[model samples]
Target chain A: MISKVLVRLKEDVLDPAGRALTEQLNHLGFNEVKSAMVGKYIELNMDTGDREKQKERVQEMCHRLLANSLIEDYEIIHEVIEKKP
Target chain B: MISKVLVRLKEDVLDPAGRALTEQLNHLGFNEVKSAMVGKYIELNMDTGDREKQKERVQEMCHRLLANSLIEDYEIIHEVIEKKP
Candidate 1:
C-alpha cells in the first residue's frame, strides 16, 4: 500500500518561507503568481494489504510523528498499489 | 485557479532528510513503514481562468524558480477551483 500525507500550516497561521518565495517569484517576473503556500508531502510505502488497516496506521503516523496537529493540518491519500502475490 | 506542485528528490539522489525521518519513525515504532520519502507541496493561486494558460505559466514557474529541475522532479496538479468572480 502507498499513502501520501500532505501537511500544511493552518490558514490562520503565517508562513514566512512561502511569503519569501512569493516575493522572489514576483521579482523574477512570474507576476501572475498571486500567492504561494508551501507544505510537506510525504510518501509512505508499507507491506500491508488491508486498506482499512493501512488507513488506520497512516492516521496514527500522522497524529504521532508526521504532523504537529496544533498548527498543521494533514490529509492522507491512501491507495493500494499492489496486491500481495 | 489553483496549481499544486509536488517536488521530490530524484531516486538516484540521496535524501538525508527523508532518511532521518524514516529512522525517527522507526524508533517511534512504526515498523510497518517500509520506506518514507519526503517532498515539497506548493500551492499557487492565479487570477486567470484559462486552464491552458495557467498550465503554461505554472510550468515556467517550476522551471525557473520553484524546482531544481536537475535534482528534483516536479508534478503539477492543476485545478480550476473557482470561476473568476
Candidate 2:
C-alpha cells in the first residue's frame, strides 16, 4: 500500500515562503498569480495491505511526526498496488 | 482560478532526503513504512478565471520556475471558484 500525504499550513497561519514565491512569480512576469502557498508532499510505501490498518497507521504518523497540529493541516490519500504473479 | 502543483524528483534520481525520512520514520516505530519520497506541493491563486489560459500559464510557471526539467517532474491541477455576489 502507498499513502501520499499533503501537509500545509492552516489558513490563519502566515506563510512567508509562500509570499516570497508569489512576489518572485510576479517579478518573473507571472502577473496573474495573486498568491502562492507552499507545502510538503510525502509518499510512503507501506508493507501493510489492510486499508483500515494503513489509514490508522498513516494518521498516527502524521500526528506524531509529519505535521504540526498547531499550525499545519494534513490530508492523506491511499493507493493500493496489486502484486504481479 | 487556483492551481495545485506537485513537484517530485524523477524515479531515476536519488533522493537522500527521502531516504533519511524513511529511516527516521522507522526509528520512530513506524515499522510498516518500507520507503518514502518527499516532494513539493504548491498552491497558486490566480486572478484570471479562464481555465485554458490558467492551464497554459501554470504550465509555463512550472517549466520556468517551479520544476527542474533535468531532475524533477510536475503535475498541475486547476480549480475554479465561483465569485459570490
Summed backbone clashes in each candidate are: 0, 0
Residue A56 displacement in candidate 1 (angstroms): 1.2
Model 1, B1-85: lDDT tens digits are: 8898889888898988888888888899888888888999898988876889989999999999888989999999887775578
Candidate 1 — which residues are off by over 4 angstroms?
A82-85, B83-85
Give the TM-score of chain A, superposed on the true chain A, for all candidates in the order listed.
0.89, 0.92
lDDT of 2 by residue, B1-85 (tens): 8899989889889999899999999999999999999999999999986889889999999999999999998888888787899
Return the clash pairs for model 1, or none: none
Please report the candidate that would top TM-score against the real structure: 2
lDDT of each: 0.88, 0.93
Off by over 4 Å in 2: A82-85, B82-85
Residue lDDT tens for model 2, A26-83: 9999999999999998999999968999999999999999999999999998988888
Docking class of 1: high
